[model samples]
Every structure is written in structure tokens, then in C-alpha cells.
Target: SNLVYDWVKAAILFGVVNTVACLDHLDPPQPPKCITALYVFAETHFDRGINDWLCKYVYDHVGGEHSAVIPELAATVATFAITTLWLGPCDIVYLWSFLNCFGLNFELWVQKLAEWGPLARIEASLSVQMSRRVRALFGALNFWAIIMYNLVSLNSLEFTELVARRLLLTGFPQTTLAVLFVTYCGVQLVKERERTLALEEEQRQDKEKLE
Candidate 1:
């Protein structure tokens, strides 16, 4: 079960990063219009429909007997992360605000952390560890995606202009902010792991004393 959960998380992260890279390389002449269309499609159809469906599926199927909150939350995060990668200037602002309001709120983190029990703690620790790796990988991929897009844009004026506009307006800022967010989350995850380890050690010591 844990292995399946881990693979699903990794798959989602990898798929989102690669999809963003592909979207970034769309036809130079049509980037502005194409990206606008994509943003509209994602917001109107994907966000309202497919995103919810995906989250529900993950919650019902993957989460099973466990609390569905974490998987659903992860799915929502992945959805926004993909949209943020593909959207334009104005939409990017709205998406970023939406994410800040719903996604990055530290209250959610506290709630997740407060859930307790030996099994729950172990599951939470493993989830945090996996998330740390995924976020780190995503951050690195985002940086390289920017670099690759820039390099490809250099060969054509139209493409260069499109890339420059998006970079100035949304791409650079969003990716940079994402990197910082991921790094912060990673640090928090490390602390979570340390806390879990300490608790486990204390329990073991107590058991020995009782024996």
C-alpha cells in the first residue's frame, strides 16, 4: 500500500513537470493564443470537473481505509502546480492567489501534523519523506525547464519574444516562488521526520524500562 502510494505521488510529480516542459515548447507563432486557450480550458473544464474527479478517485481508490484528506490534498496540489506551469500572465496571478489561499496555508499543515497514533505517525512520516523528495525534484525540474525554454527561444525572434513576455510576466516569478515553497516544505518535512524518530526512540526506551 505504501509502495503504491509512493509511486502514485512520484508519477504525478514527474508527469506534471514533463507536461509543463512540453507546453513551454508550443509553436512560437501561437504561444500567446494557445496558452490562453489552455488556461481557459483548464480553469473552465479541468478545474471544475476533471480535477475533482481525479481527487475523488485518488481518495476513494488509493486512500481506501485511511483518511482521504491527504491524498485529496495532494491531488489538488498537483492540479494547481500543473495549471500554474501552463497559464498566462493574468491567469497566473489569479492561480497564485488561489494557491496561496487554499494550497499553501500553514493551517492545513498543522492539522495534518496533529493527527496521532503509532500507525498514523509512521504513515505521516513516510508521506512527508516522499513529499520532500518529490518537491526537491520538482524544484530542480522547474529550474531546468526555464533554462531549456530560454535556450530554445534563442533561435527565433517570435519564440524569443513569447518566452521573454511570459518569463517577465509569469514564468520566472511562479517558478522562483515554487522553488522557495518547495524548499520551505522540505525543511518542514525534515523536522517532521526528526520528531517522528525521537518519538519512536522514546517509545522503545520506555518499553525497555517497562520490561
Candidate 2:
């Protein structure tokens, strides 16, 4: 699992660097093509890696003790993967901005770590505290910076025109599929949350009776 995570991270970082480098040397059409390919590659590997890890975790831990949440969690992860896979290159800025603003990726990682045994729980606790401090220190400033940068770049006539052409040429179907998947996943997530809360409450009431 660690090996897979490390390799995926390395691939994404490398892809980002290569894409930027290509922009400097490649011609207009060639660079976009190259970037599109890299984007597909990164998103594919990233989603698969995450899914694999989650499955492994479920099999190891949740499969025995918390089986009830498996379907919901799997659906949520699947939705996330599908949405990311279909997002056009133009959507990367928005994705990055959202992640920066909420630190969703970081929070997810910490949550997973907390599910692990004792040592990982310690790490997860520390991570939560550190994340809170980091957010307190820089979250607002970083969020605004990301928002402004993306807004400026996306608002440009050239960029907007490029995105429009890309969408017309290749992004429409992918975007539509992503929206449908997200809607389905959102419903699943809500149902899962309610179910989990009810189960927790039931367990609490039973414990009170026992006491």
C-alpha cells in the first residue's frame, strides 16, 4: 500500500513537471495534446491507487468490524474517482482551488490513518492538530491566492476561448458523465451518513441500558 501510494505520488509530481516543461518547448497543439495525455494518465493511476488502498483497508479492518459502511464508502470513492477521471484539463484549476480551500485531501488521508491501529492513530492525531494549526496560520491567505490566480487565468479571453473549444471538441460527454456520477454518489453519501448516525445512536442507547 505504501509503495503504491509513493509511486502514484511520484508519477503525479513527475507528470506535473513534465507538462510544465513541455509547455516551454512544444508547439501549441502538441503541448495541449501532451498535457491531455498526462492528465489522463495521472488521473487514472491516482484513482486506481486510491481505490486499491481503500479496498485493502476495508478487507483488513472494516470488513470484519464495520461491514455496514463498506457499500457506502465504496460508492463514495467510486464517485470521486469517476468525477476526477472525467474532469477536463480546464477543471484542474477549480479542483486545486477547492482542495486548497478545504484541505479535503489532507483530511481524507488523516481520516484513513485514524482507522489504522495504534501507531497510525498517534500519527493521525498529530496530523489533525498540525493541520488545524496550519489552516489557522495560512488557510485563508492560501485560499484567496488560489481563487484569485485561477479566476485571473480562467477569466482571460484566450483561456476562455481555448476551454470553450476544448469542451466542444472533447469535454461535453465526459463532463456529463461526471455530473451524473456525482449526483448518484451524493445521494449515496447522504444515505450512508444517516445510517451510520442511526447505528451509532442505537449503540449508545444500548450501552446506557447496560450501564
Candidate 3:
């Protein structure tokens, strides 16, 4: 995957750096702490590298931000496709690159949408619960989209079989939603715990300064 998706290398680099930082005092890997290591190494692939650089510097200006959504999506996807072709062609490298671009750009598109002045007034038309529910559902959908992106890059399965698997998985939307809801709850709990820990640490530092 590091060879196929440049982002993987960035994540492994991130993990190794953190591992080394904690090497001095952390407990030894018992039961291998395999799950923790996997969590650290698996998720750090948000890096964009040169592919998205071209998107920002080259294609994004072709129509400016004011362009129609479809054309804009095409131009952005094409930027990565062409970049992959420029690098080299093996088997549907451009296709994965297009998928990769789509995955990356979805976040950007949402950010742009949020920044749109009219979106505030439009969001006002919806109830808070409705908006939150819709956003949470979209989060689950996006998670599946990302699963497809990762599966494509893994390049282990035939394209047709991968499509079949995705079709099979879609039948379990409820399962995905349940998993996402549980994950969200855990994340919120962890975030709150971290916030409290950080506040306590800051207070300790202040007390030390006063002493």
C-alpha cells in the first residue's frame, strides 16, 4: 500500500516517530499491544503530497471556485488521474487515483459548502436534530465511500468482485450505522477525557510556575 498509495508512507512515518518518542518510558509491548499499533499505523493516511498540490495549483483555477459541481469534480478527479498517468501506468492506476482524489476532495467540498454564505440560511430551515441526524448519516455513508477507496488501493481483488462485495455490504446499512454510532460515542468520551487531562496538566504547570 505504501507503494500504491503514497499516503501510507506518511502514516507509517507518523507511527514510527511516535513510537520512538514513547520508547523511553512506555510499557513494553505485552500481548504485543498489536491493536494500539494497528490503530496508529492504519489511520494516518490523510496526507495529500503532490497529487493534491496539482489540484490546488493547477486544476482548481481552471474554472475557479465558482464552477459547476460536476465539472469541478471532474477537473479535480482528472488532475489526480493525469498525475498518476504522468507517474506511470500499470493496471488501472489512474482509476485508483481518481478514487483517491474523490475521497480527498469530498472533505474539501464539504468545507466549501459550509463556507458558502447561503448555506447558513438554508441550514436554518432545518431543525437541529434533523440536521445532526442527516450529518451523522452522511458520516456513515462517507465511511463506506472511504472503505471503497481503501479496498481499491489494496488491489487484492478483481474489480468486478470488489463491486460485488460493495453491493453485498450495502445491504447492511443498518450494521454500518450501528458501528458508526458506537464509534462516535467512544470518540466523544475519549475527547472529553483528554480535555480534562489537558486542563489538569495545565493547572499543574501553573502551580509549578507559581512555586
Task: Rank candidates, TM-score, best first.
Answer: 3, 1, 2
Residue-by-residue lDDT tens digits, candidate 2, 27-142: 22111211111211112233344445544554233333323344434434444444445454355544533443233333344445556799565556677656444333333333
| RMSD to truth, every model | 19.9, 19.9, 8.5
Model 1 alpha-carbon miss at residue 7, Å: 37
lDDT of each: 0.45, 0.44, 0.55
Shift of residue 135 alpha carbon in model 3, Å: 1.5
- How well does each candidate superpose onto the true structure, as a TM-score? 0.21, 0.20, 0.50
How does model 1 fare in lDDT? 0.45
Name the TM-score of candidate 2: 0.20
Candidate 3 least-lDDT 10 residues: 33-42
Question: Which residue runs does candidate 3 get wrong by more than 4 Å?
Answer: 1-9, 14-46, 100-123, 158-177, 183-211
Candidate 1 deviant stretches above 4 angstroms: 1-47, 54-76, 89-91, 94-98, 101-107, 113-211
- TM match of model 1 to true structure: 0.21
